[model samples]
Target: MLSVHEITELSEEFETKTPQEIIQWAADTFWPEIAMSSSFQTQSMPLLHMVTSLNRSIPVFFIDTGYHFWETLMFREKIASEWKINVIDLYRDHRWDVFAKQNIRSLPLEDPNLCCYLHKVQPMQKALKDIKAWISGIRRDQTSVRAHAKILELQENGLLKINPLLNWKKSDVQEYMEEYNLPAHPLYEKGYKSVGCAPCTVAIGVNDDERAGRWAGRGKVECGLHTDMFSKKDIADVQNEFHLDITKVK
Candidate 1:
């Protein structure tokens, strides 16, 4: 693996390379240690296509909250078939118990943030434990928080995050998918630009639908996995408040 300075230099050079070149570089360098996480969103088409095109066997971890839309599950299977990717499913083992204790079933009805904490974020953190690098299809224009996302990042947990398409625009993703004749998830045509759990994700009109329905009136857009899901300060606070050891949740 390259040193931090070496990584920065190579990352600058990587900007001009095509998607295939980047994937090959990752495959040759990271090899079996690299993996991807996909929510099966239509916007993910380009990255998924690129990874599959490289013909490398990389694990694609899917967080199965068991609350996803049926269409999402179908799309997951479809992509796995097309790409022949190694599929790894993750679910919170105590999900049912936690949901029962917390009474979280639907969208805003349940604390969507905690629901994501117990289901998606917790499982994802554990599933990614051995992975040194993670690749995601995040783009700059997706949200305010992502505007500064780099092509590569050193995550809080020391995981190397590769956002090869961080520079891509929504139109860029659409164009690549169309050019490659990639089949889009059926939900995209239904006006769902951002896909998540079925209840939290409802169709919206194209006009200023900046993830409007996600977590609905709760005003919470993240599942804690992306945001404070596991911040160092927040973890310390939680541990102090609960009078519990840190390793329990981690």
Candidate 2:
């Protein structure tokens, strides 16, 4: 029940060791219940490499929104093949017939955050169920919401969410990628800073926030997954519409 700042304080106080060390520590900390979620963004390469290279492979969850660009799909396939690792595909329910009933092919254009919560946040919540801890590559410099995000925290999902690279900056990420000789997302060099559903992602211009390109001009920046999940209004909206009831989401 730590406040966000308190959660961040704990992470900062302990200070993360090498990628290899963090994985080993998590093994001891969360044991068989630990899971890692990845987006295959270039910034994630180092940690992904470290975890996948371990003797016992970590569970790598990918939230395949099914709306990704061809390049993204290609990159994911390539990484999975090259790494020879297990990548569990997590997805939103986009069954065409079911979607057609609501006359919605994507997020309700009228309410993009609502769209994001249903398609992205809620699914991920279910996808990570029963896991005592989850790991991610989110960094503090990515955006305002993430700026306060820490390397380890208790997500309102009630899971012990760990962001090992929370303090990493764009520069630290780049250095790690280069040192590991990792392959970056193809669209990354093409100017896409943040990668997501192609329909929702765009290339960032100079001086723009790293994530500003996503859902550009959509009023909301984060897709709801990064917010203070304890907020009554936000959680209620997800529960009422998408059935992400905290009591039953598991």
Best by TM-score: 1
Clashing pairs in 2: 151-163
* Candidate 2 global lDDT: 0.71
* Local distance difference test values of all predictions, in order: 0.73, 0.71
Q: What TM-score would each prediction reach against the true structure?
A: 0.85, 0.82
- In model 1, the runs with Cα more than 4 Å from the true position are 95-102, 106-110, 229-250
